[model samples]
Target: MQYLVLASRCLIGVVFLASVSTKVAGPAAFAAFVRSVRRMLLVPSGLVKPVAGVVVAAEAAIVVLLAVPTRATAVAGFAVATGLLLAFAGAITVTVRRGTRTTCRCFGASTVPLGPAHVLRNLLLVAVAVAGGVAAPTGGSLRLGESLVAAVAGLVLGGLVTVMDDIRALFHPTPASRRH
Candidate 1:
């Protein structure tokens, strides 16, 4: 049970950290991704940049809050995850209604488009966050060994996901026929 809870927490922490790192590392790319979604949604052009900034900042804060060792951190993480999922659901609904094909800006500059997959992903994250919040860990202080291992695992997972695009491209080189 302890290991299960620890695993869940680590997964959520990794996900949140990855999501934010993408935006923080490439603000301009993230901003462009957001702008594309806004255009697809027909959002007012003036509001695009501000909205992107707010989203990026919120994601970063959520990652930091979730990574820290505190009881309240789980609650805070759940709230943020829930809010993001709801917002994503709304956006996906609108995109479907408007017959717009737009990429989900959730992961910053990924080429993956906004679709049912994105909605499902958020829903899954929401579930994980809720579970972690409810089962907030309580124990004697973490030994330095445990803390170090958890932190390293979280960072490695986050870093891998953050560079998923590059990683994929490296393994699956484009065919010459498709490269024009």
Candidate 2:
């Protein structure tokens, strides 16, 4: 159980880090993607850039906050994950309503379309965060090796998933064909 909790924390931390890094690495592209999604929902165009900045900052903060050795880490992770899930859900709804099948852009330049799979991924992360919050662990002792290993594994997992999106896009091409 303790191992599971630790693994969950690592996974959540890695996921947040990867997600934020992608956005930070390509602010213009992320902003453009945000604008595309916003336009689909008929949101005021003026708010797009600001909203994109806020989202990127929030995600980065969540990753940093979760890495801290404090009780607040779990809470912050939970809040971040919940907020992310809600945001993605809203985006999915808007995209579906507008009938605009654009790439999700969740992982930088990935061609994975915004769909139920994306929503489910966010929801699963939310669940992991919530579980971590409920089982918040003390960070008194320094298990540097173990912790480092977990963090690295988490990051690798995130990278693999992001790459998988690209691989699927390459082989499958269109979103509709990939879906079936």
Candidate 1, residues 125-176, lDDT tens digits: the string is: 6676677666665544556677667656645654564455456557665532
Models 1 onward score TM values of 0.71, 0.76
Tens-digit lDDT track for model 2 on 23-126? 76665767656755575554577877777777778878777777775667766766776787677667776676677777666666665566766666677767
The numbered model that scores best in lDDT is: 2
C-alpha lDDT (0 to 100) for residue 128 of candidate 1:
61
- Clash number for model 2? 0
Best by TM-score: 2
Candidate 2 yields a Cα-based lDDT of 0.67
